[model samples]
Target: MLSGAAAQDSAASATGATPVAGTAASALIGVSVDPSAVPDSTAGAESSGSARRELVSATGSATQPGGDAATATAAVVDGSGASAASAGAAVGARHSASTVGGDSVIPPDSHDTVVILLPEMPAMDAPGALEAAAEFFANPTWLPDLAGVRDCWLVTVGGEQVTSGDPVPHQFHGAVTAGFRCLGMESLGVSFRRVDLAAGQADASRAAALVRAVHVKNEPELALRDGAVYAKRLEIDAVQRGPARDADLAHVVIVGGTGTLGVEFCAHYARSGAGRITLLSRSGETAEVTRRLRPIRALGDTPIIVESCDVTDADAVVELAERQEIPATVLVHAGVNYVRAELAEVTPEKFREMAGSKIYGTEHMLHTWPRTPDCRIVLCSSAAATFGGRGQILYATVNRMLDVLARRLRAAGVDAVAVQWGLWDLEGPLHAVGTGPVQAAGVTPMRAADALAVGFTDHADHSGAENRLVAAADWSDVQALMVAIGQGPLLDDVVAAAAESAVVQPDSPGSGHRDGNSPRIAGTPADGHRGTADSAAYPSGPDRVRATVAQGGTKAMTQFRAAAGQPGAAGGNSANLAERVRRQLGRVMGADADALDPSVPLVALGLDSLQALDFRKRVQVELDRDLPVAAILGGASLDDVVRLMAGSQA
Candidate 1:
């Protein structure tokens, strides 16, 4: 509990900014002000009645010294002392900085903006220091001189905090990012650089180097080595390796073996030479279980045991473990019940149903087995646990507990890791809805085997981190992908922040950067799959889709001709064209062509922003004519779309 004054003083000495007006400039974890408010040192000072405001709106929760709530607002003024909107609507969403434990923005008339930096410390102290540093940054400061200056802050945190392969760290980062973005949207000219301290503690010199990077508008995660700071780049080595001849897996126990991810895990281990896999779940006989077992059966004579066991029942789990003759070498917990509802709509019963398998199930297994150092326990968590997918509050909460459990088990010397995974390819409920929705959020579905391969690597590498988060796309793309996937209104501010951060780090290499002519898709057969050479590779998701479309020109034309039929031969009549357009639209809508009304807007028929983009692309290909998006989504009926298509051809 360091006092606000002492921390501000430490920051002032470190940054060399004058500690003017007491602690007014102390709580500046971040601040934004119009530069014009502060007079130039070379020019004579001009007094403007107006004052600059905080980077974000203040909650006015923190009271003033005299018992009144402080108002947070800034008056804009030009050189002539007249009020104006200095930086107009460009400011992002205005939120109370006070909510983040930071003070309100200085009264419109104050001057000075101070940027606080985290102090150099060892790996253990880094998390605490980071929390302290953010508090130090919370001191409110308003400087006319700083009104125009924009800057970035680099906060180095624990590698375990990030790479523990869990959603907890991701969730922490997501919330902090959301707050910082609100500041940026307020035109505070502030940005963030989070350096993962995976390598270890950094010295002052290295910290200074990071500052220099931020000053240059390059916000990269930095690490210290040999007394020098180096940028930590994010890379995905997705090149599939050859299956192990002597796989470490033998007797594998898969919880929820009938579920999508669980079956994939079994298949992966089966290919890796597993002799026996016991599938534990409430129900053993399921069509999904039967279908997914085909690939596993093809790999070898491995016997798959489907046992009826409810993981949530501790007594059942204990009894089942006692009856098992072979101790499980690898344990895969992939059981989860899906639930989607708004916070208010979610009842406690529904929450318990989702939490039973994720939280209670893991608890039961760990209690039943205790600590077996040789056994590698893998928990399949979700990306939604971090990003908190739309209408999935309970899911995120329970999944987060999995990451915490991993840490606790790791602390006790158990070999366990929780993986925060993106959507899986052609699996479960998502498979029924199609992959477009998840891909729209910028996540490429990792083929089931590929994801499990990463899990095996995690268990083997013992990266020392208990949690690891893996995704197919760069982290930056996630926000946009979420928007495209239909979380636009929910994540509008988040998307804006992500886009600005992208602008700040133009030179940083992204995970999704094309390696060559083709983008690599996760889980596609790599060099080792099917005994093929490593050379045969294909990209996944949109990149894969793009490549297929590029090579389908002749095929597209053939399909178009078949679709056109007699109407196409009748010189493109408007009525015939409208009928054809209706059919095409119906196909995209996943509806019956005859059931769709010709005069209804596509938007009303469930055409979202991402769906609209696809609709446009499909119409362009099928009709051989490009139609304006407005004519499709903006109250445009089927007949209207047809007219537009016909006019383009003419």
Candidate 2:
């Protein structure tokens, strides 16, 4: 953090205000200045107009790298032009104070350096606070009024200064061009006092008032909670500006088109109103996957090309590329593995089982996918890539490889990303994904359907930079709502929001929002506001933002552990029982056994969002004890749902 006087100096300079020119700033620890030099607290500065009397108000605290709280002092110019000392703001961020203080004065001929005082600090241990504070210094802004900075300092005291603000983060800052990384730190919290705001005798209050606009008056200044979960500064800021409302509905190709995650993505992009779509798979499953995509297929002539191409075969991939059409975008998820071994115990075969998908397949996709000027490449990574686990070397290594992969793509001038997927609920097909069983853990897993929706949005908006998308369970609901939008004026607000952000929309080939069953105009206008109905407007990547599909806060896609009352999925005759249950459900929804797609919106029919709310009631009437909502939602298919129907099946 820069000194208060230094802050005022730099900020004023950024605004093009001429510096008082001739006086130097100073820093002194804990010494009360002479009464003549300090500004009187009773006086106040008025607003732009009116009978106002408030130059500025102060609150918040300053923190060192890791300690809880530390005190810092700034010398503000007094009313008589001498500098005075003052306290900082609330919420733990330090700032200058000149509102009640006088202008700062200095002996033009004397060599007096403003001695800003930082008293002793207390210990603090907020998990990401150091990273946040580091980001703040790297780029300090207050609300809508922060200025660009050139250089600044983060000083720690020695001896008495050392005893008080002990163990300050002593990263270098005196000369210039020094690089100090703030990946993780040990200290935080500091208290600051104005040492001296001496710009040719500018009054302390006047100097403090210079930075009044930097403080937050309306919105609450949020800080990352001290934990593993808090988001990075860039991510937190990006999330607040909101998600992009407009998207390209033009053409795109998703290579791993049949896997649960891949197909789900195809459906979302199709639903998001893309023009032409080419869905590919290793086998001949694309046709069936496309057939199940009714909402997207309804978009008309949107060709869902199902082709067989082995991703691991370089020649086959090259041949596939030769026949492939260049899409505005390409998403490759051809690499997926079934490895589930402890790192120490994992064998070459087990490693190959996992490697065959991510590495070889992705390499093939990179070589084969037809490139376009507007095309973007998405490399799906995992949360485990950033944070490793005991039995997840295969999974974690594959995820991390994306970072290097994205960088290489960037160096090649192609839009690329390594999206780290959080554990999704339906990752049952994936070997490394299972996180024990869900019932024992209260983790909220993401559905493959939801994960795909978020992934597609990432695909459409990726700017080619190295990105990591962290999918939280909340993102599932939010992105699901985004993908559910039917076109026309209803999407006008979305487009407008996108335009405001200077982002572009894809050229969609289909007419949107033809929901004939609703009473609302085919595509009704939203309350037509931005900000609300928003969760997807943020950017798509961050090293810390781990792509949160269904896993993250919930459990990994580990194998399902059967409850005491139910038999294990593999050992029991659950398949036959599940099929019978599915048939019953199909009858309830007025559809054939095969009509339902695992990921489509149930709201399309008579079911409302509240449909899930009724599961507990169903459990009581049909199966006895109340079952969790996830129990019903996580069921592989509606046909064989176990939680509510388990008792009946038994």
Candidate 3:
């Protein structure tokens, strides 16, 4: 079925007129099926009904006649049988059909097969263009119909985006294909293909050949260039280290230098003998910033400058760039801002805020910097841009732009690389959103110093690829999460690496299991205790209190009261409830129960949305009381939560 734009383009092209400005000329140029092929008189009706059902099942909505733009095409089958025109008319679509021979018919085996022609995306810089493109490609109206087909081929143009070094406006297509590939693997169990045709190669014969190739091959990624089909594979090139790799560390400009990562970069460069360092951030120098810089300053005679500059403000960035006396030998764009939100909850404004620094900030920095060979531009992108993460659609989209920007810079002979970093073992931006979900997905946080070392060394040695992913991951956990999230093909290399180095290590000290394959919650103790070690090992003070909460029951509560040491409440009273809440909160926040003051608000104790949910669930399960998420995260103290839970129970 042709989209409204596609139909109009096809009509215009057929009449020797110019196609619409923003639409590609597309046509359904296959032979029509014989109406008498179906012996059953009601076969056409059944097929039409099946098509509608399939659409509904795939997208949760069925296309109705004369509906919106998406439903411009519909399935229409006559009483005799389903033909190309009748099929289109049945589903509210327009098509031109031609019959080859009188006996020509759609084979029975090919009934469930489908080929989806994705429309070419226009420039996304225009207002509402990104949203429109995202809606069209990422959540395409045609995607739903693929759910009904046993075999499907998703074809698009512009193989240059993936194959060539030049950057193209194909970010939307990249995201769309990645998402569908995962969807196909996890749920549909259907054959899927993303055929990227070269210029002037968009035709029925070329598409048919690609579809035929897909049937015989099991490759997930295939691109057509120079009239030949090629399979795409992602591989890691071995680093070849050379001398003077650290020469660029003499002078450094670290953007977002007040944040956790910024401080780490500042300290690392200082220790590496950087003669001068300039730190730019939205938050100007504060006492805490001074305190953090003190250690770096003590390392050597390196002059450290901290200035307030929002990188997203183009004027601010330009002003800073112009005022620099000595050009920075190294430029590290570590600035980032984002909130953990599902795609449905990500408004355009929220996306803009999240993407502002990374997109416009990177552009502004790159434009201002002199393109000298000595200068190295290091963009701190995230693994979400590489393999995607849950609740990070906007984050991933913006980071992917960084990856593309790096490539574009390299293509223009600028020394630039985007490092797709994984979770870091630091109290940085991710901490605000809570690290529970990422940890649960099997990503072990890497030490900040070690990750930086590896990223820089790898980039210096292996300068071929403009974008690289540096992460330490448990492949089994990653694979499981990907499967759960309907992700496919993107992690094939990781899967292979996991297979190559699979080992069975002995269980850790507190874990109850001997087998190495069992899934463990991030901060839970071996015996299912939230925040304490085994009671027998540390049989005193807060440990005993924590153990009692872990081993909860009426008898355990009695034991907890006896072991409280200073608590006045007895037998399921507010004091007992407060202790349990404290231990559980400590567990969820990955903090020490004794260190968490009861009077302090949970938010001040670093409680986040994910932690709050986890705390709420634990309360529901252990305390047998329902606690609202708001009551936990709405600036409530331990005593407040205890009172709230006690009241709910009462």
Q: Tens digits of per-residue lDDT for model 3 on 1-650?
A: 01110000000000000111111111100000101111124323111111110111112232322323221111111212222332332233223221221233333332344445554554343123335434543433343333334445555554234322213434454444433443332222345555555444454435334333334233445554433444433222222222234365667888888888889888877766787888999988999999988988998899999989988888888887787778877888888676555544556666566667777677777778543465888788777754555467667666666665664565566777677777777887787878777765445565564355445532332333235565544433344344323233334433442232211112544332323432111132222212212112221333221111110112223323333432432347778778887887888889999998888877777775446655754654466544544444435788887776666445
Q: Is candidate 1 or candidate 2 better by TM-score?
A: 1
Residues forming the 10-long window of minimal summed lDDT in candidate 3: 7-16
Which portions of model 1 miss their true places by more than 4 Å?
1-247, 285-298, 432-436, 454-466, 470-650
Better candidate by lDDT, 1 or 2: 1
Runs with alpha carbons beyond 4 Å of true place in candidate 3:
1-116, 121-156, 159-195, 199-205, 213-220, 226-236, 240-246, 369-374, 460-465, 483-493, 502-650
Between candidates 1 and 3, the lDDT winner: 3
Ranking of predictions according to lDDT? 3, 1, 2
Best by TM-score: 3
Query: In candidate 2, what are the lDDT values of residues 405-512, reduced to their tens digit?
Result: 553455457766556665565654543455532211211344443344344443324453234344332111121121211001111222222222210111221111
Cα RMSDs of all predictions? 18.8, 23.9, 20.6
User: Which run of 10 residues does model 1 get worst, by summed lDDT?
Assistant: 6-15
* Candidate 2 wrongly placed segments (more than 4 Å): 1-250, 286-291, 325-328, 431-433, 437-442, 447-466, 473-650
State TM-scores per candidate. 0.46, 0.38, 0.56
Residue-wise C-alpha lDDT for candidate 1, range 1-650, written one tens digit per residue: 00110000000000001111111010000000001122223211111101221111122122212223222222111221111121121011121111111233334224212222232233222123224323322322311233533332324333223221221222232223212322321221222233332233333323333222222222223322222233321111212223333434668888988777777677767766687888997988677767778777888899898998998898998888888888887788988566654433546566566667776687788778433457778787765644454445555555655664564555556767677666655557545646565554344554444344444432222323234444333222343223232222222222222222111011223212233322222222222111111111221322221100001122223333434452352345787767766776777789898998777777667765445545644554556544444345345777777776565455
Candidate 3 lDDT score relative to the true structure: 0.48
* TM-score winner between candidates 1 and 3: 3
